[model samples]
Target: MAVVVGVLAVAGALVAVTGPAVLRWWRPRPASADLIHGPGMWAALRPVLGVAETERRRTWLHLPVTVGEAGARIVLRLPAGWASGEAGTRAVDAIVTGRLPGEWAAHWCRTVAAPYVEWVRNAAPDRPRELPKSVEWMQTGDPLKIHFGETPEGPAFVHTGTATPHIGVSGETGSGKSSILYIPLVAARLAGWLVTVIDPKQNSLTEADEKSGIRIHSETYECVMAIAEFFVSMMAAEKYNGRKYRGHSGPDSPVGRLLVIDELPSFREYVAAWWKYIIRERGFPPVLVWFQLILMQGRSSNHRVLVGTHQFSLDVFGSTMARDQVGTKMVVGEVSIPSWTVAYGAGAPMVDYDETIPGRGVISLKGRRRKKTLADGRIERAEEIQYAYITPQVSDLLDACPPAPAWWDAGAMAPWITPRDLARADSAAAVKDFLPGGRFAGGREDLTPDTDTDVQLTQGSMPRSEAMSDVSGPGAVSGVGEGLAVADLVEKVGAEGIEEQRYTIAQACAVGIIRKKPGAARQYKSAWIKEGKPFPEGEMIRGNASYTREELESVFGTPEEDADSI
Candidate 1:
C-alpha cells in the first residue's frame, strides 16, 4: 500500500508540471475569425487585461467589435479615466496589441466628453470607380446638398447655404482639381444657381465651359470687372434679403450666385498689381473685399465662392478671414505637410504624400450637425474620399441650362472700360500736335504789323497785282504767325465749298486738321498751309488770323486760286 501511495504522489506531481504546457501546445492559435468574435476574443483579451490589472477595471469598460468588408473594428471605452492623456492612450495601445491580432491597427480618439480606443484589422478592398449620375437625377430641392463623390462607405456630400458658403480645393498638378470643379459647377447649375467661372490659365475650365455653357472669364481685366459686377448684385440681394425677397431656393425666390475661381495662384499672379495697390494704400483689393463681403453675408444672400489653388498658403488667399471662413476644405494627392495643415487643420490624417492616386483626398467639412462614424466607431468630421469621375455625358447634362452671361453683361450699374479703350484714347491725343491743323498752327491775331506797308495791305483794297505784291513783300511778315481759324477758312471757302468737301470743325479735329490750344482753351490753328497760294488778305479780319503767302505756299502745295492765276 505504501508503494502504491508513493507512485500515485509521483504521478500527481508530474501531471501538475506538464499538464499546462501540454494544453497550451494542443490549443488552437488565434485565427482572424477567432480574434473577431465568439468566446475566443474574451479568452484572448483576458491575458492582455491582466497586464494592466491594477487599472484594467477603471480603464476598460466594454469591447464592441464589428466586422465589415473593409475590416474589423474593436472599440474599447474608458468610462472612468477617459480624460487621462497620452499616458492612458499608450497604456490602451499596449493592451490592444497584447490582446488583438498582430495585423490590427489601433487609433485612439478623445471624444467631446470621453475617450475611446479603436482597433482596426484587415486591408480595405479596392473601391470601384464611381461615375457621377446625371445632373437631372442628382438635383435636389435642398440648396445645401452638394454631392462630391462616392467612397467605400457611401456617397459624400457638402452643405453650402445652410452650413457653409465656401469650399477650398488644394491639390498638385493632375491631381483631379478639375474634376472637383466640374462636379460642383454641374451641381450648382442643376440647383438653379447662376454660375461664374474665373479661370486664369483658361485651359483648366474651358472644356466644361464649352460642353456645359457655363460662363467663363479668362482675362484678368474681365475677371476683375465680373467680380465687381457680381459684388454689386450681391449687395442688391443683401439689401432685399428680408424685405423685398425671400432668402430660400425656389422658383419664386431670388436666384443664388455661385462663383468658382480656378487656378488661384495664376489668378493671383495676374492680379499682383491690385495686391500691390492694396498694400500701398493699406486697403483690401476690391476683389478680396467683395469676396469677404460675400463670405460674411452670402449665406443669407445666397452667394457662394469656391476657390482652387495648388499653392496652399493663407497669404496666397490675401486675407486670414477669407481663408478661415472656408467651410469645406479638400486636399488631394502629394501635398506638403504644411499644405495638409492649411487644408484640413493640424490634426489632419497622416496621408502618404508620395501616393499618386488622383481624386483621392482628405475632405473636411465644418458646421456639420451630424458626424459620420468611421469603421472604428469614432465620429469623423473629415473623411477619406475618392471624387467621382466626370464623364462626357455628365458634362452634356450641363447643356440643359443656358450659360450664365458674363457678370458685367448682367447689369448697367457701372460703366465698364477696358485697357484697350484707354490706350486708343491716349494714342489719338498724343499725335495731335504733328497733324494738319494742330494747336500750334494758329498764331495770335493781336500782334502788330512790322511795317506801315503791311498796315496799308491790311486796310486798303489795292489792285489784285498790288495785293499779291504786298502779300509777298516783307510788310506781310506778321501774317506768317497769324494763321486763319477753321471758321475763317470755311467762311472764305464759302459754305457751299465747305459742304462740297464734307469738312467741318469736328471732322478737322478727328482727321488731325486742328487741335485745341493751351493759350485760348477752345481755339484752334491750321498746321497745314496751301503751297503757292496767295494769302487770303480778304479773310483777314480783326479777331481772325491769316497766314502769309509764303507761309501758305510752303506746307500745303499750290492753292487752287494761285494755280489758276499761274
Candidate 2:
C-alpha cells in the first residue's frame, strides 16, 4: 500500500508541473477576426507592453476591441495618470499598428480614433486596385462628391460640404503634389464653381489659368485681396458663427468657391510682408485675419479652403483653430513622421511613404459620422493607395466642361467669368485683338490681374483710380522680389501691333484664341506649315500643334463672339 501511495504521489507531482504548460501550448490561437477579442493579442504585444502581470490585465483584461466590415476600433481603460500622453500612446500605437500579429495586422488598417484618446483601424485591401478613368468620377452626378483617387474596391471618393469640409495635400517636392492638387481643381472647374489657385511660386499658374479657368493670385497683396474678397462673399451669406471669411484652405476651397494655396510657406511669407506694410498704414494685421475667419466660419456658408504644400506645421496657419478645422488630410510619398502628424493630427496613421509609386499616399477624411448605429464611421484608408490621375487628360476635361448659358454672362459668378471662359484670364490678349462684335475682356478693367478688389482695402484707404492703376514698379513685388516670367507676348500684343511678336497656334489657344481641341486648329496650322511660310514651329499643348497668340489670332480671328473664350 505504501509503495502504491508513493507511485501515485509521484504521478500527481508530474501532472501538476506539466498540466498548465501543456494547456498553454495547446491553447488554440485566434485564427481570424477572433483576435479582435484581445485574448491572444498579449503575446504579440508583450515586448512593447511588458511581461508584468499588471500588463496582462491592462491589455487582454481591460482592452475592448470591436470589429466590423470597415475596420476595428480598440479602446482602453485608463489608469491613474495614464492618459493619451506619450507613454500611453506609444503602448497603444503598437496595439493598433502593424505591430499586431502579421495575419491580424493584415486584416485591418491602422489609424487613430481620436489621436491618443482612442485608436480605430480600417480593413486592409483584399486585392490590387486598378487605375480608374478620371472622367468617370467627374460624372458621379453630384457636384460635391469628388473622386480623389483609387482604392481596392474602386475609386476612393471624398465628400465636400457640411459633414466633411476642407482638404489638405502634402508631399515632398517630386512626390506628385501638383497632380493631387489638380484632382480637386479639375472637379471644381468641371462643376463650374469658381476655382482660385493662390500660387506663390507662380509656376505654370498662367497656363493653369488659361487651361482650367481658375482665378490666380501669386503676389502677396493680390492673395490678401483675394482672401478679403471671399470674406466679403461670406458676409453676404447669412452668419451663424463668428469667423472671418477669406475662405479656408487656400487650396480651399468651398464647393462653390475654391481657394488653392499651392505653397503654404511662400503664402505665409507673402502674408507677413503684407502684414508689415498694412500694420504701418492700417494699424492692424488685416491679411491672415480674413483667412482665419474663413477657416472657422466659411463652412456654414459653403466656403471651404484646400491647401497644398511641401511642408506642414501648425505654424503654417495663423491659428491652431484653422489647422484643427482641416477635415480632409492626405500625405503622398515619403515624408517625415512629424509632418504626417501636423497633416493628419496627433497619433495619425503610421503609414509607409513609398516615393517610387506615383501619387502613393494615405488619406483620412474627418467627421466620420456613423451611417447606422453599429456601423464603423471611419471613412478613409488604413493603408496607402495611388490617389492621383494622369496629367494628359486635363485639357480634354477642360474643353468638355462646356460653356455656361449665354444669358448667364451678366449674372456670371461674382467675377463675371463663364464656364467656357473658365480657364482664361479676363484680360485675355485675344479679346483685345478682336474687332467690334462682343465686349471683349468684359469688366477686365475693374479687376486687374494683379489685384482682385479695390487696392484701397490693401493700404488702409486710397483713391479708387489709384487703386485701379498699375502698381507694378517698386514695393509691389512679393516674396521672390524679382520677375521670373519673361514678358509674355500675349500681354504685349493688341496695342499698335505690340512689338511685332510671333506665336504658335497652341500658344494662341492657351491665350484663349482657339478651341483647346485638336480638330480644326491642327488642320489649319498644318495647311499653313505645309506651305513652308517660316511659321516659327510651335509647341504641342495637348498632343496637337499650337501657334503664338498673334499667329492664332491671325488664323482664327477671335471666332466673333467666341474671341474671349478659350
Query: What TM-score, computed on C-alpha atoms, does each candidate reach?
Result: 0.49, 0.51
lDDT of 2 by residue, 398-479 (tens): 6566443322222223432232332232132122111111121111222223321212224323433343233233212211
lDDT of each: 0.52, 0.52
**Once model 1 is optimally superposed onto the true structure by TM-score, how far is the C-alpha of residue 273 displaced, in angstroms?**
3.2
Q: Write the per-residue lDDT of candidate 1 for residues 15-99, one digit (tens) a residue.
A: 8877766757565554544335534444444454343535443244444333443466666654534354676566656655565
Q: Give me the runs in candidate 1 sitting further than 4 Å from their true place.
A: 1-142, 210-213, 244-253, 274-284, 352-354, 366-380, 402-566
